[model samples]
Target: MFNLIKNEWIKIFSRPGTYVMIGLLVLLVIGAGSVMKFAGVSQEPEGDWKQQTQMQIESDKQYLEEMGGSENFQTQYYKQQVAINEYRLANDIEPASGESIWSFVNFNSNFVEIIGLFAIIVAAGIVASEFTWGTIKLLLIRPISRTKILLSKYITVLLFGITLLLTLFLLSTLVGAIFFGGGDGQPHLVYIDGAVEEQNMVFYLIKTYLLKSISITMMATMAFMISAVFRSSSLAIGISLFLLFMGGTATQFISMKYDWAKYSLFANTDLTIYTGAMQPLVDDMTLGFSVTMLIIYFVIFHLLAFIVFKKRDVAA
Candidate 1:
């Protein structure tokens, strides 16, 4: 299995496109860091964090009053922010004030979407390209079972995705440190259950990275399944990108009026909602429930992909 996975890994990196993807990631990291430095995105607060927190709370409260009994999504979001800012001030916790490695990674978590897109591209091509290039027979002629071959390819795709994610994190951290200096062991302020708490910056960043990667993983799996079943890399990539970019927005809109939206795959994939960064669309949604939903969808995707690949005839 190790040897097979290694071979598959080699095959992935052998493609020029893989190197291009890595290059793009590096450029993006540097570009974002430069932009932050030049645009004053990392300016330090003039007053104490408590003062800043108070000002934020007051501003949000005034906005809430202006909102005047409108319980729309935007109002709820502002209310949540007010609660969090108030908690920060009361607990003497520092609100995020300036740019640092921690802040950079936290903000750049959005780049995980880029990583996801790259992973989808790889996954969409991994299997279908074998068929497109007439390499499936060459792969199967080896001394391995069909299951092993499929597993190796899948494993390699996951490793590639993980590699890109780590590269993003590490590169962003290095660039951030170069520009903003070290964090001096700052703590991330988190608001949960009507309380403010402190968590280690590194730990929080790691958790954030993992949670963000979940959406990428699910999207890649879907792409991989489509590639295997349809044997068309273009089709697989196109459909997966559409879902990656649009599915979440569509789910959010549907969730506004429908309870069933809670069970949608997109709804469950973003585990960050449970971290108190935002509220769940449904009041009853919980970490455990979202995790369960993800597991179910993950299993279904893998089962379909594996079953189809295993039963497929290379001779055809």
Candidate 2:
């Protein structure tokens, strides 16, 4: 398995396109940092944070009153905001102020989507390309079982994805530190079950990045499955990329009128919804439920890929 994975990794990095994708990711992070540094995007507000907090509390209260009796997601959002802001005032914990390394890292979290895009591209092509280039015959001619080969390829794809994520995190941190100061040691305040909790900023950022990767991981796995089942990288990439961009929006639209939408892959992909950051699409969806759903989907995708690949006729 180690040798197989190593071979697969070598194959992935051997291509110029792989380097291009990585180069693009690096350039994007640096470009974004440069833009924010030069555009005078101040992370700090001018007035007293206490005064600003009070103003925000007042605004939220007014909005809540205006939205009374209409209990929906927006109402819940305002209520969460009100609770968090009030907690900030009561605890005298000032909101994050001034650009810092942590702040820049948080900002760069948006680039996770780009990482997912590149991963999906790689996953979608990895298996299908073997067949496309008529290398599957040579690959299967080895003494290794088909399952091991497929697993090795899948593991390699995962390793590649992890490499991209780490590059993003580390590169963002470097650029952030260079452009912004080290950090101000601010605690990340999170609202949970009607209470605000203070968490280590670094730990919170790392957790945030991991949570955000769930959707991408699923999409990449699905792409890999498609690639294995159908010997066409173009088709696999097309479907995966399309859903990667539009699946969540379409799922949200359906969720507005249908509670069953909660069972959707896209709906549950965002585990952050369970963190009280926002309301779930369905009122009853919980973290446990989403995790279970993801596990089911994960198993199903792998089962389809492995079963098909093992039984597939390569003699043609």
Candidate 3:
């Protein structure tokens, strides 16, 4: 299995396009960092911390009142923000006053979507390209079982995705440190279960990135499954990319009216909603429910891919 995965990795790196994708990611991060550093983009709020906190609290309270004391998700979110801000003021713990390395890192987390795009592209092509180029027969002629071959390819795709994520995290951290100095030792504050909590900045950032990557990973898995089943890279890439970009929006629209939308892959892909950062799109969607939904989808995707690949006729 190790040797197979190594071979697959070597094949991916042997292509010039792979390097271009990686290089593009690096350039984008650096460009963003440069712009943030030189364009006078203010990462910190202006005015005295106490005044700002008080104003924010007032704003949240007003919004809540305007919500007519409803128990909706947005109402709950604003309440949480109010609580956290009140805690900040009562404890005399001012927020970070200036842009720091951690701030830049958090900003760069938006680029994780781009990473997902690239990973989906790779996943879409990895298996389909073998059949498109008439290399499936070559692979089938080997002594290895079909299941092992497919598993190796899938594992290679996952490893590639992880490599891109780590590269993004490490490169963003380096660029952030170069442009913005080290962190100011402020703990990330959150309001959980009606109580405020302080979390380590570095640990929070790491967890945030990982949670954000969950959607990307699921999309890549879907692309892989499509590639193996259809044996057409273009088709696989098109469908997966479309859903990757639009699935959440469509799901959100549906969720506004239908509670069943909570079972959607896109709805559950965002695990961060469970982390106290935001409210779930649909009520009653818990972390355990989302995880269970994701696992079911994951199993179904792999099953379809393996079953189709195992039975596919390569002799034609």
Candidate 4:
């Protein structure tokens, strides 16, 4: 079983597309960092701090007039602006824009949602590709039990998942730090119960990133089950893509008609969206509900995959 998993891992890493994906991730981080770094240095200073601050005040006043000045996120934004103006006045700090590229980089550094999807595709295709390419016969002829073979393939998918996630994390942080100035190491703030508090933002970011990785694994498992049942790689890919896009849409109807819709996987996919929507959708949500839905979705997908894969005959 161990050897089988190792061989599967080798196969996954050796694929040309794997390296291509890695290259793309690095390029995105570098390109994003470069754009922001230059943007800060290149912008002409908005000199005359007093005038600039007044301009912001007028802008906020106009916005308040437009919205009738409700106590909302916009109002909060302006309140902070007022504080910033006071700070600038007291300290004699010109509105000198420093390299905030690192902040931008840090904020976006953990966008592993789509990147992790690529990992899911690779994993889904691992066993399915062997079948598609007529290599299943060779695999089945080995002395290993069918369950052991499947377990090995699944373990390889996990290793592939972890490797891809770490690659995104380390590379983004390293490149971001180098291209931009070093971190201010401010507390990463997470919102709970409509209040923002200083917390371990870095750790939270990592935990969220890992959660995205798990979501990708769930996607892979979904594809694997489809591939196992349908015995067609194209069909598997089609189903995965359709569900990937439309799942949330379908869940919306359920939410309207039935209370059970909160448990849909699509509802949980974008943790960012669910996290006290900075710009919330109608009927804003709770974190507990989203987390619950995701857990059930994953468990059911894996259970279905195991059952169907174990029962299905390999013959084409």
Model 2 segments more than 4 A misplaced: none
Best by lDDT: 3
Over 4 Å off, model 1: 47-52, 68-70
Q: What's each prediction's TM-score?
A: 0.94, 0.97, 0.97, 0.75
Clashes of 4: 1
Q: Write the per-residue lDDT of candidate 1 for residues 5-92, one digit (tens) a residue.
A: 9988998989999999999999998898888888865466786767767788889889999989977767867887887677666666
Off by over 4 Å in 4: 39-107, 245-261, 273-285
lDDT of 2 by residue, 262-312 (tens): 989999998877666788888888899999999999999999999999999
Arranged by TM-score with the best first, the candidates are 2, 3, 1, 4
Would you list the clashing residue pairs of candidate 3?
Answer: none
Clashing pairs in 4: 188-201
User: 177-204 in candidate 3: lDDT tens per residue?
Assistant: 9999899898899876668899999999
* Candidates ranked, most accurate by lDDT first: 3, 2, 1, 4
| Winner by TM-score | 2
lDDT of each: 0.87, 0.90, 0.91, 0.66
List model 4 lDDT by residue over 1-316, tens digit each: 8899888888877889888877787777777777777654564455776777777767866776787746655665555555555545555545534554345544563556556566567656877888788887798888877778777887777777777678777776777677765655545444444444444546656766765665677677777766665666677777787787678678766676676665667766666653322422224556666677677877776677667767767776
Summing lDDT over every window of 10 consecutive residues in candidate 1, give the lowest-scoring window.
88-97
